[model samples]
Target: MNETLKNNTAAAEVDTRETVLEVKDLVVQYVLKEATVEAVNDISFSLKEGEAIGLVGETGAGKTTTALAILNLVPDPPGVIQQGSISVCGNDMLNLDVKELQKIRGKDIAMIFQDPMTSLNPVLVVGEQIAESVRLHEDVTASQAFDRAIEMLELVGIPGARAHDYPHQFSGGMKQRVVIAIALACNPKILIADEPTTALDVTIQAQVLSMMNDLKEKFNTALVMITHDLGVVAKMCDKVAVMYAGRIIESGTLEDVYNTTLHPYTEGLFNSLPRINNKGSELKPIPGMMPDPTRLPKGCAFAERCKYATERCFEERPASRYVNETHTVACLRYDEPDFHIEGVED
Candidate 1:
């Protein structure tokens, strides 16, 4: 039994030397006419090769904005990446020229957006959509691209023969598979799935997630899964980042964050989830709505909602402090000298 435990512990550790994606102190803001809204505050994280990271937060917490910034897809009119750097495969994504970026996008990194219906072009055949993605990234012939598209369809569990059908002809789950096919058409090293299972039924959701897990392993693709579902995070991710407003308030291995939750916002999220074991227990939802991005609070964005918030929390921003080598929390409570709170050992 001791040997088994030791083996499990060894397997859980990730080698950081081979990082696939790196985002450093990224800041993205929307330049609205009335006021500038900071959509993504100074956030930083890294993705290692063939690992999955879950980004969990309530709506308007800037999860989607961060993903958009990674791909340099944030619209310029209202949205802008003000500061920070994003490096994928050692390529500076933010500094890449348009032509260079265009070459790198699908070839090195691809995204499966939130809504499959909108993401897939209704006018075009599903096969053509995937083929176009491949053709754009690689210098392949039309026939070769189409052949690759059919192979991708097969890879995602859809029949290669059905590739000729248009997006409207397939079911919602199938359309999502086609979208995945398009994203993976070039065999990208990184895949960003933003709420990939949101629109599916429970069974189909499970199926899609299973398929994604299988495909990710088969291709050795690093993944960023953006979702509010802690259940999904527990099932799919090696590490997790809990976001509030625009900043990542807590980050660590799945066991570190879930088993020994540090941030009040993260704890509140777990409390809100209905547990099969805790029958009849009242769900404790986090109090207060997300702050308006245009007029954010002076200190911590979650201070008003955090039950454990103190005077320091409302006065100044807390620096990220490491509870250990792998776990970190941006909370004033951790910085309280000689403080020992329940469920936290410092």
Candidate 2:
């Protein structure tokens, strides 16, 4: 087993709070006639009640696939969860039947998809869409569900009366608000928001993020926020996981991952970002593209692009190791007794 599974499990063991979500050694892939795509590989993490974690990575890093797998929503023909287990509130998610899974989807765990435009139905009024989810999970009449839907709309900062409007009638931000209402209508224990603010303007993005953070606190919901934006992770997440080529290369508290980056891929992400304090400095973007999922390297996927990579890094897959109580990094450099990233203190 990789150290990721062992180290993450050990981290979970130390936490005293109730674990609302746990994913153990998850491996997801897409099998096509052309070639098999390795998406998520042996990733493990757990979330306590009301805590939030950020799945930060570039596109095609399998953030969305991981989220879909948790809800058992991965399309069957092309996609498959070849191994691993997903647990939500002590219920085994992968083994649950469709009917049982349906019960948990909206109530126990809800997802806010990437795009708000395609997520909603234009034909149906926004109120009914939110009401549908409420009706599905709760033992309530249509009128009660509609009432709850209006309450949800109001909670999301939309006028309760606007619930009668169709999705087309609302602006991009408002439509996103409506989508948030639908996801939160059932008061889910866990919420997986997959780039909820991706489509909005900067002003609206802050508004939406603030609103989601407020609602999460109000509902005491554990959140798995998937995004490519490190700024978003810094603002919303208690813990952060940096994924590269379908694996979590580094994970820890926000301060640990952001301030004390251990993995080369994660350091590259930070280096690529524009810094206000360093206005004249050119951005040091990570060189080369992400590895092809179908033709992933047998060793470290980032070895080819990594400036610090040694011959050993290209020949052997690195195992995750603890840098501190909460911080874990998958880098062979950590295995050496005296090795350290040039400027990072011991």
Q: Which 10-residue window in model 1 sums to the lowest lDDT?
A: 337-346
Per-residue alpha-carbon lDDT of candidate 1 for residues 1-346, written as tens digits (9 for 90 to 100)? 6985575477568443367899999999999889999999999998988999999998999999999999998999889899999999899999889999998899899999989888988999899999999899889999999999999999999999998999999999999999999999999999999999999999999999999999999999999999999989998999999998899999999999988888888877887778777687777787879999999999888899877888888989887888887899999887667764354222
Displacement of the residue 139 alpha carbon in candidate 1, Å: 2.5
- Reference-based TM-score, model 1: 0.93
User: Which portions of model 1 miss their true places by more than 4 Å?
Assistant: 1-17, 337-346
In TM-score terms, which candidate is top? 2
Could you tell me which residue pairs clash in candidate 2? none
Q: Which candidate leads in lDDT?
A: 2
Q: CA shift at 69, candidate 2, in angstroms?
A: 0.3
